[model samples]
Target: MSRSGGRWADETIHRIMSMTKPVTGVALMMLHEEGRWRLDDPVARHIPQFADLAVATADGGRAPLARPMLMRDLVTSTAGFSMIVPLHIPLTGLVRSVPVAELYRTLDLQGGSLSRMVERLASAPLAYQPGTDFEYGVTHDLQGHLIEVLSGQTLDDFFAERIFRPLGMADTGFELDAAQRARLSTVYAWGPDGLAPSPPSVTTTDGSRGSYPSAGGGLYSTLDDYLKFARMLADGGRAGGQRLLSPASVRLMTSSLLPAGVRQHFGQRLDGLGYGVGVGVVEDPARATAMDAGYGRGTYYWTGWLGSWWWNDPASDLTVIGVTQQEGAAMAHVGLPQPGADLRALSAALVYGALMQP
Candidate 1:
């Protein structure tokens, strides 16, 4: 899409950050279509390490989990996980020593692998019981691990062969070669001083070749490349004359699955919002009156920490993607209104508004 300042060509690659969750979520659903696993299955079934987990009580003690974390909980963000470091908990020392915490401080941490990340996550207590609340954490990262287990392929290989290659999303993946890196936009953080170049230590953009192929928030892609993925969803899972996912799977991915109580929290983020598989869906039109941006229901979208956003509204056959490398933009929304300052809402307004032409 074009902006006032200059052109954002189809070849420009940007850090998609958390936008990777939906992509990973789609991959998992593909496996589901093959009967490899069910959404309600306990995550421990695939990663036995989570067989016996704990819950972090506010009283400064640990308690046995009320129930196992279901696989659906991971995608829906109802698995009682939070991105917070939880340094005050009983295992502060242990948690700090784990490499996962290093990722919080900076993405430059080396030698840390996704396996150890899962092991560390298992050791930590859940913020709440599975399916009880909405908390975002390393849920999708665990999904990535499960994908590896079931597909017998690294996350990168799985994406390359299954999703990226099939959709012809040539510019989307974890690793970027030198040529790809050259086109990557610089990440900036809005701080006390002003908008300045974010520290290079933020992440290893060299590629997803690192040990941590963070399924939740790690991927790079160009505008046109990601548009293909989004439009595929908008077209009921078909793009380039190929069906990447069945219509039923696409419906399941975009439909509202949030618990009643959690629905309120989702609403708080965006009026009438509901948690779908890996993105937010507009569930209550009345409640969503403020932020619909002329888009109708059945609109599913998600963004990244570095201020990138993408959404597909099947009702209108429209897809919009905005990518910019701006950290600390929407610190409150966890980068939802990517590049901060309400750009996501504005983009929707402009796109849908223009389409209203006679």
Candidate 2:
């Protein structure tokens, strides 16, 4: 089903993009279970640079935070910082008339080490007061850096020693060797004409060259490799008879954690789903069924930038993971229709229909 020229295989590696957020979430919660830090702990406790943050005003002024940003705020995306603004609402008029591609380029060029980037984030004016609303940005990346700070290990190393090794996920990681590079799918993007190959810098995973590990959206994985991770979550954090996370942790990670005020804003982005620790949880089946016929109230899923997607639906005892090289996976990118929005919905509909065909 992948847009890559060859038939999709379980071994093919593709940049899973934001799908990495859930993995980062699991990693942080693992530390949480270890008592390394509490969810409500102020982020300044570990990263002192964020102690005093200013909120950005529409009038081009700055305001103080009503409250400190909490670790849990990052987990639920209520941190008041985001990588993007709505297209119509210009970012201080800086990007009002800029093309999406140019905006992306500006972000790409601002890169530095993860910690350095976080420092830059701390200095920037937040869109709103922390813990007051939902604003999805690089919160997980901050969590990832927090993992390194608290665990005293690189994010990739922490994942390796803990989750991947125990679950038998050999093909998942930030960097890939020659053999893995060979299995990577050819990335394609939709242009005015049709689908065409995308540039390597946009699609390929070059861990050795990137400024920092993008705990937010940087891992490369295969369909089978990610499914193993999904299955672990669905199995109440157990895999192959080993418990990677406590059932309570899994439950908290999968359930909605948004405050009432934030819930409305989150709903605007994802109509029937609620924001969990890292993944999106199905809350209203009747509304979600409009997106995907297979989506049930408890189905949990997330998508990558390049279109790879996975979901664990308890209703049907279904765990589905798909890999594709389409440029706008999840329809998060520009130049596509609303139905072209997240191919995950389409894939789920088709898969569910097949399941019903006795």
Candidate 3:
């Protein structure tokens, strides 16, 4: 598939999925730099809809939260919002399949605004309270909504100005145009049943088209375009001599943000690995499991659901992206062998191998 004017031919368009989180994170950082919002600021400060939130309990009960959710909590996945709930067992399997419009309708029926979603989330209780544990879910999507509220621009527009346009990532967006759509790779899934095609679906509020521009998992991009964005992060948030983020912000975004115990749990195999704002940071190679084979420390990266991956290894001054659209059992079994050849690992291996060649 062509990528932003055919910069890279072998590489194709990637169904970015959750990797969209990092892109959204960058946009939030830009807004923070502009003084539009602060990390500690209450989300309700700008989006008043979130003033009173609640948490869910283990017994399926709910209670009011001691405080409103802070912006940092949403960025860090500590907000306790989940796309799945144990009580809603029947809906678990259909979480992804449920149209975004339907999801919103359910939320609306429950009298849940984005803010109320947080409140109800808090009252329902969390696997862990805000800032207590590391979990990944729809926090970034809330961040996207926060961006909409603060910037008065849609998440798509915010990303276009702060990230895509600056990094020359022309082929990155929540939706593709007709010509680009023709090049979209087919999504595939492997299960106990067998291999099957996984067609793309619109997952936005209203559902007609993706009006909600999900920051959590709503983007399609090509390898070359994504590479530019990765390269900018690798280059300390500057690309083409344009400073998109201050060096300090880049450092902050790529540095360890979690507590020591949380970092250890996530990076147990990697002696010096941790999660930064939106990327995984490798601090020590010796502790990393088999995944650290040829990788260096201080590597920052993230991946998409359909096996797409990208990394910025400051240690090597390199950035790489691998694109594909396969998930589930295919990923567990034939997707990539032994050291696991998923896009993230393969991309890292390719770059590391090339570095060792000379």
Per-residue lDDT of 168-235 in model 1, one digit per residue for the tens?
89989888887776677777776567777776566446554566787887788888888888888887
Candidate 3 local distance difference test against the native: 0.61
The sequence of per-residue lDDT tens digits that candidate 2 reaches over residues 1-358 is 3333466677667788889989988998899899998878998898899988887766767888888888878788888765543343344322221333233334542377777777767666676777776666567778888899999999889999998999888988888787777677777777777777776655555434267787878888877788889989989999988899999999888888777645524213445667788887888877653355757677777777677777888878788887677766664322234334467667877888888732
Residue 116, candidate 2: alpha-carbon lDDT: 79
Residue 289 miss distance in model 3 (angstroms): 5.0
Give a tens-digit lDDT track for model 3, residues 1-358: 2323343354356577767877877877788788998778886787665565555554545566666667666676665554532232243332322332234335531333444554444333344355555556556767777778788887778888878887878878877777766566666665456655653432121111253567777788877887778878777788987888888888888877765565423212234567766776777777764355466677777766666766776766666666666652112211222222344555556667778632
Worst 10 residues of 2 by lDDT: 93-102
Q: Distance from true position, residue 268, model 3, in Å?
A: 11
Give the Å shift of residue 53 in candidate 1: 0.5
Residue-pair clashes, model 1: 3
Better of 1 and 2 by TM-score: 2
Question: Per-prediction TM-score, please?
Answer: 0.85, 0.87, 0.77
Clashing residue pairs in candidate 2 are 307-329
lDDT of 3 at 225: 82
Kindly report which residue stretches of model 2 are placed more than 4 angstroms away from their true locations once superposed: 1-7, 84-110, 204-209, 264-268, 289-292, 332-342, 356-358
Best by lDDT: 2
